[model samples]
Target: MAHDLTTPRDGIPPVLSTPASFREAAAALASGQGPLAIDTERASGFRYDDRAFLVQIRRRDVGTFLLDPEGHRTEFTAALAPVLNGQDWILHAAPSDLPSLAWLGLYPGSLFDTELGGRLAGLDHVNLAAMTELLLDVRLAKGHGAEDWSQRPLPANWLAYAALDVELLLELGDTMAEILDNQGKLDWASEEFEYIRNTHSTITGPAEATWRSVRGVASLTRPEQLAVARELWMIRESIAVEEDRAVSRILPNKVLIEIARLLPRTARELVRVKGFRRSEVRFWGEIIQRALESDPRTWPTRDRPPRGLPSRQTWAAEHPDSWERFSNARTLLDDLSADLAIPVENILKPAVLRTVAWGATVGREIRSPLDLPDVLRDYQARNWQVELTAPILTETLFR
Candidate 1:
């Protein structure tokens, strides 16, 4: 029978807020036995920045400690460093929490990502709630994930929800590890967890022409409208950063795209746009007008070159022979994924595969699949990934 986890197995402790409290919690954790079960909650949709508002950790000996990093930032890291360093931190989705935790100067020397472990073990649903119920037979409460963690004095229920997140993480990790070992993919899971721990967050840099990512920007054919979209996007971003509000809360993409398309010249005209009649637009109307009224020459003439490779959809038309080879490689990858019960993307990223396929035919001396390691290395594929897929790619591409 599935059991509903109404509260922490060892009751929720008061949040450690002050320097003294943090130090005490840290000391307890440092002396605690076994790996630390770690998790973090962030106000992603409610705030502009993705900083952790609350961090929850658990250990067998130390019990559960909820640390509020927002106020005790300085003491939090110093106190927790001794415990977190060189410890196997077990987390459900490490990537989501790692960046925010790293921002506060806390990093794990090693980690066991249960989500990745589930993937390598070929479990269809790897979410915490699903995994917990499946492996540990406990139902986690839902509907608290999007709560505004930036708010002060978190409610009792919210605190309970937060503490419960790390409650079964250790158990889940152990069960998933056993499954992966039985499947003979424990090594693969270890490689994946290490990769997650060391890999950089994808959101580090300022994206170029971020306006282009808006939904309807492609429909705006005129340079003037594109310029308007860029200006409006920048203005919205500035407001979001200054007010610490999410850009979507300030103005939705649909509204911004509508303003760009209409090229509204005045506050009145801007308000006339379908989605711009909200109170937020009333406050930001002048800023939008200023962006639209700037001289056309002042608008951006062209977008910067995209940071990564171009879309693969164009490859067939641009290079038919290379496209054929890529298709063959993709087929082989599909077969491999099916045989191993792993996702195709996990076996090899499509972008890396495309680069190799295109390079094999154009301006490169890749004679056989054996030369794929050099190509894969240039593309930053790990040794384990190359070992698994290189042989198949060699046969498919070379023949």
Candidate 2:
């Protein structure tokens, strides 16, 4: 049985056999539609981060093309820049995909997330397959559940899986839009979707660290934790970059924090940390030791984050309304998320909510939709984020 691709793929289905084909495809992408449907597949089970072992972009009215980031060296600057320059993109779960794309030098713009739309519109089940089935009556098969996308000459099964991955996205987004419009929730979802498209990559460089971002580290002495954190952070950064994977692939934050607090001074000390398996220590033990031994006092304090967590009592005292608002927001988020068949956390992350709460109270602003990231002034001036803080703050705090 001959399989058909999602679309004609610019009349030449990007083979990605060489640089020339890639360049041609990139040019085609720029000249194509204003919005595109995109998905990526990587060897995540075997590797650390989700990278474009295979990048699939389907431009409405144009076609879907698969880019081989590994084999093709065609600069994505020209091809991807135009699409992202001032265009809207439709994606189901774009938040997860876009970050990794940024690492590979592609950042999308003006997103319309159907999953988000479904939630705002009070619909049920927003996963691509479910949404497509409900909206378009297309029962996309899910056979390629664990296919390895890194392998060249992608298998027929995988290609079908990939094609079906985006075949109904454009239609599904349109259906979700109609539903949103009917419910008077279009503006709300549109605001949130715009926020999603404009999201920037959180991972900046090796020098800037995230291991210390873990909770409970504040219990440790600031200097000691900072020194160990910097060391572990740098180690993780190097490992991630070298392995071309996410830092968590090297080790999760819990393990990293545990190691930092323990300040494992030697290979033998490494064993005390729960997740620090012997092989991991064998690979990174020396480096860890050097970091633990470094004088925390001498380490630069300019960017050393304060190591601590706020007591529940202190948090409650600081923002009496927050707990209620957070609780209300969580229930709303959970209900809507379950209705849309997406994870609740996907719609409103608690970390983002924390930042929103603090920013509003400290900055003295009111924002809408009480449970998103803070509408920072500087962030607002620069990026495309919606100034949603004002209304959210008012409803959640003042009201």
Candidate 3:
């Protein structure tokens, strides 16, 4: 069955070739009446950003193919312009491949991210291989290696490994779709996929700020975070562009956040921050110190909300039922995810869960899907009610 299904072990492969080959394969693929399953593996270690050095695409009906962007002398900018322009590419965790694909001057018209789809469907383990095992009862061989794709004479084994990635995507998607449909979560999957496809292009180059990508950023005072982040980004940008290296390589986000948190005003103070790699400190310490020293007045002195905000313990004391309610809701969601075959984190993130707990405590509803504005709304509603009743609840309810 494998022999018949796959291109023979010996033969000129039918991947990207002349325009005629591309036309024929694309025509067959288009007629297959199934969404394509797509995956990308890139030399992330070698490159500054996550990109698809090799693209693997599979149509359930037509089999899988590997496209060597570095090979074929194929001007992808022109050759793949149309596919990027129109087709809805099914991807797993689409962001990793966005930079590289966007680099190819091919913007995917839409996307069907199976990983996100699985999450919305409520699957715990969304890794491609694991999903394949659960849905198809087939185990995929692990294919990662240190072999550099930029090298000449790419091994046949490597090619096969690459091709195998996409080969089962369409089938996997179909299986996942069946599960989603049965679970009545197909709309959720569609929402996630369409959200990915309709998103704006990723920002690259010096203008891009690392702060936008930083997690837990809102924990810091907005002005302090904003100024420190601006300075850190400028310094990182200058060095990254000059050295042609990744920003994280020079100074990881952890160190950057630590620096901001400490608000180091001098070289001496800067050295005390945790995990401040000496090499990085030596390289960019002065730049950071200078930013810190620039304006004591301008730097945010106000305490950030939620960092050391009033404890959940306070809330728990006032409304004893709140904790129980939150626990019940969380347990309910976790069990629901497991039963429904989705990841718990996908249904409601920890931050979102926090908002829900706080909201319900003060008599608020969690109606919005997981989003920043929705979370903010939850926080606002809960705080207003909690604050209003705080004195009474603390005195009468606690006593």
Per-residue C-alpha lDDT of model 1 across residues 185-214, encoded as one tens digit per residue: 888888888877777334333334377888
Extract clashing residue pairs from model 1.
none
Which candidate leads in lDDT? 1
Q: What C-alpha lDDT does candidate 1 achieve relative to the native structure?
A: 0.81
**TM-score list, all predictions:** 0.89, 0.68, 0.64
lDDT of each: 0.81, 0.63, 0.60
Judged by TM-score relative to the true structure, which candidate is superior, 2 or 3?
Answer: 2
Estimate the lDDT of model 2.
Answer: 0.63
lDDT of 2 by residue, 99-146 (tens): 666665666557788877776665567677667777777666675745
CA lDDT for candidate 3: 0.60
Weakest ten-residue segment in model 3 by summed lDDT = 1-10
- Each prediction's RMSD to truth: 3.1, 6.4, 8.1
**Window of ten residues with lowest summed lDDT in model 1:** 200-209
